[model samples]
Target: MSAAPPTVFGIARLGKRTKDLTKRLQPGDIAIIDHEDIDRVAAEALIERHPAAVLNVSASTSGRYPNAGPRILVDAGILLVDGLGDEVFEGVRDGQTLEVAGGEVLLEGDVIAHGTDQDDVTIAASLEIARAGLSEQLELFAENTMEYMLRERDLLLDGIGAPEVRTVLDGRPALIVVRGYHYKEDLATLRPFLRENRPIIIGVDGGADAVLEAGFRPDMIIGDMDSVSDRALRSGAELVVHAYRDGRAPGAERLEELGLGDEVVLFPASGTSEDIAMLLADEKGASVIVAVGTHGTLEEFLDKGRAGMSSTFLTRLRIGSKLVDAKGVSRLYRQRISTFQLVLLALAGFAALAVALWATPGGQALVQILGARLDALLSWFTLLFSPRATGS
Candidate 1:
């Protein structure tokens, strides 16, 4: 007898594998992407859509650095077929019903492409190999940082060429949010602070959506405008397009097409959107700047697949004592009362009330009333704690 064929599941949905592709993804659709060294953010967005399977044309974990993306996908029970090459995209049309089994992409009962199946064991091994190459990455990062420091010293030290914006930041706290790692959790944790303080909220790229989700309007939206939604553009937030230092504003075109040309402030600077946002706040004389989900640690920068966080490092140095991480704030700040505390406080209040009533002019009458209530309470307790009759 012939061996049984492998079970195939779900229809295929082909996309460029960019973070922008998350907007079009539907649940249970197999995502075909060309993303190499998929970062945590991209993986997270893809995972949220509940993709049936992921077929990557480019290397998901290229072993250049230990990216958490492939591991995250596999750990979530999502089937990952890594490095199928560009042929997979050429053969698989968008919305085509393709069967994926054992790392083989099948179209109309024929095997179209084959890839390495990414399971826990395979992903772990890849991560180990990637870790070994981190020394080289670190060296490259250090070099890049030094180069950036030399180039951006004027901007960092002197606040040269900082654009003037209508959104006033003088003597006010500014909350700069980025759609990076644990952004939602940080935002939720800082709810009380946001409500009480009402800091000028600045959203970087897709962070605009996050700000909206957190029930706060962004005072300023800053980025290349690639990942931000059209709704967010029309959100009445002051738009600042991050352009090149050479005065080329590509993101301005997006706003112009959306009929927001007149409202936008063109900020031409050579840095990441988060960096620009921080600099803008600092330059405008913000008293304090609280950052949510922005990359700070070395590992975090690497997780975003960056060679180095030159702009981020310089921005922090420029901001000095005013900069604070939302994660740190969330962890250290305690505002909410515990249930145990509430119960204990209630018991203490009842005891204090009894003592006060006994010391009053109507103490005798109050004691009599309390005595009757106590008797009733004892009777209720007796009934509650009494053994119930059970049927055999």
Candidate 2:
């Protein structure tokens, strides 16, 4: 037979980019998967890429890892290796091969290591048993967590936005809040929602950049002291200062720097910027509040590295249907670029290159500079066009 495949290690760290992992996977590349706690949406996206084999980093079928990753991998007829730890991974890299026979794994380590081929029946049966047990646990865990967060929400906001406040203008519609980095991505997804009739735009801190870059202007800004620049704050948008739960207006210091105290609207809330935005829209009786880049899940909260998203989880219920998470809406309204756009853009690029190249003695130098600029522009563009690609 041809040379046996090299053993591969699976990573289980939080924030592990599954796309990156998928890119590294060659056919027959074995991966040690980590984190059984991945959400359904994220897990499905990862599994659709199709890695060869997966070994669960955790034993005991714990719901602590992503439920969907392992479950889908198992169902897709991929190998499911469980209970292997760091040492096992290291051993694989050190030239050991894993062999399973009967109901047990056999491994040998040396300059060149090998493993026994285990019976397929035993492997399938064992994986199925573990999957069944884990799926039940994960479903229960998600249900309980969602319920718990919803209950703990208002209490977390107490002495904060508990009293609530409104600042919407009589003639202005509710502001559509957005953040930077993925401005184009946000705009593309939001344009359909804003077609013809639209919500007044608002910027939270740096979100003003998001607004302007997307060719829109902010009607209001909501945040603490830092992030929002002088030019942005003076953009004639209404300013709302989100204070701490204890009523300490921390951002007031910056507002003083700009001499905007009289113009500031302070609302104390123990939630995030997006949360405050949603609350403001509701309190002001805005018809609807649409948010971009708003945190909507445990993974997002964890990505934020905060101990609790209890406030965000709670604030949603308070707003209920009045609030729309832009992320889900963005996904739904994502536009597919036709092959025509790609072909036309390619032709246009080639024409631009030809013109620049034939223009002057400095044409090549100019072309080099232009190329660099285009690369930078594309780098930024990908932040909107393909977020996963950037991470990879």
Candidate 3:
């Protein structure tokens, strides 16, 4: 008879929203999410939490496009299982002990649901299929892009609809940070720029937390407020809620609960909060806008899984001339000071000081005292390393 399947055990953690779920995930916990065709950004977040395995209630990769999420998870040594349906949610509860034996999920030795065990081979096959059908996604993207331009032309061309915030951005560069991929690294690299220009800092959604993490308070926080923390919402930064076209603000209610209803300004617009922030900066006459952790590549846009990405594409097209990526700025703006240059500058300053000192009687006396101390230090060093000290 064949041996029974190997049961890998872990604590179950569930969240319907992958972004909110990742915040509470701990090492060795089994993350249960309902993410469909999980994007690279979500995969990266899960990887950060070091989960033992991920069990998805929906498709991990649909082969509609070559999403890098599942591939990233499997390669990072995290076990991925998908398509177990919503039955798993009903069967399992948070913090309960669960067993994953191949494609089957078990609780108390009873099978709850079964799914496909994703690996390098399976994910690779999915990516191959996705790439083969890339042309269709591109065609859809073109259609969406044209439709977006028409719907948002007034705001896109004239910056007509973006609401004004109290934060002053005129004639200065604005740094718009999003809590997306590689944001921490990009923020660290922009330290010099931050110190030099002191650009108006705007954080989108949870990006306010990122700004605080990087040791700066956000000048303004703009987003739907779904992912941001309560601390960030109360962080005293000017809050601009990204509301729907119908003027319904989800974030505003949360602020009201926090007793901050009077402080926020609702800005109704289409597209992602990332687009809203960039537009806001542009409308306020920011000389330049620097984006950190915002979508750039075609795959990234698709990974977002938003029809609003058409708005992002057009948003860039509208302000492409003034907007720059943080990576570009970090690469080009090399203002790092060298130790050798500092030493040389110090020597030059000392020489100038010595010359000026010699011109005055009191200054000359002070210089002589300093010169004696220097001679004594050199002589002591020389004596300490003298040839006579060696037995040879």
Per-candidate TM-score against the hidden true structure:
0.86, 0.46, 0.83
Ranking by TM-score: 1, 3, 2
Q: In every candidate, how many clashes are there?
A: 0, 12, 0
Q: What is candidate 3's TM-score against the reference?
A: 0.83
lDDT of 2 by residue, 1-392 (tens): 75453344332222234434544554444544444443343344345555444544444134332233344455565555555444544544422344432212344522222222222444444445645554454465466557645544554344234333344443445655545223457677676566665777778776775677677778878888466668788877888888886679879878887888878877766557777776666766677777776666654554343445666766787778877656655556666888899999999999988897868778878778989999999999888776463553
**What are the Cα lDDT values of the candidates?**
0.86, 0.57, 0.89
lDDT digits (tens) for residues 221-298 of candidate 1: 999998888988899999999989888988999888999999989887776889989998998999999999999876
Number of the candidate with higher lDDT, 1 or 3: 3
Position 246, candidate 1: lDDT:
89
Report the candidate with higher lDDT, 1 versus 2. Answer: 1
Q: Report the number of backbone clashes for model 2.
A: 12
Predicted structure 1: lDDT: 0.86
lDDT, candidate 3, 198-227, per-residue tens: 999999998999999899999899999988
Better of 2 and 3 by TM-score: 3
Q: For model 3, state the Cα shift of residue 6 in Å.
A: 6.3
- Misplaced by over 4 Å in model 2 are 1-173, 178-183, 328-331, 337-392
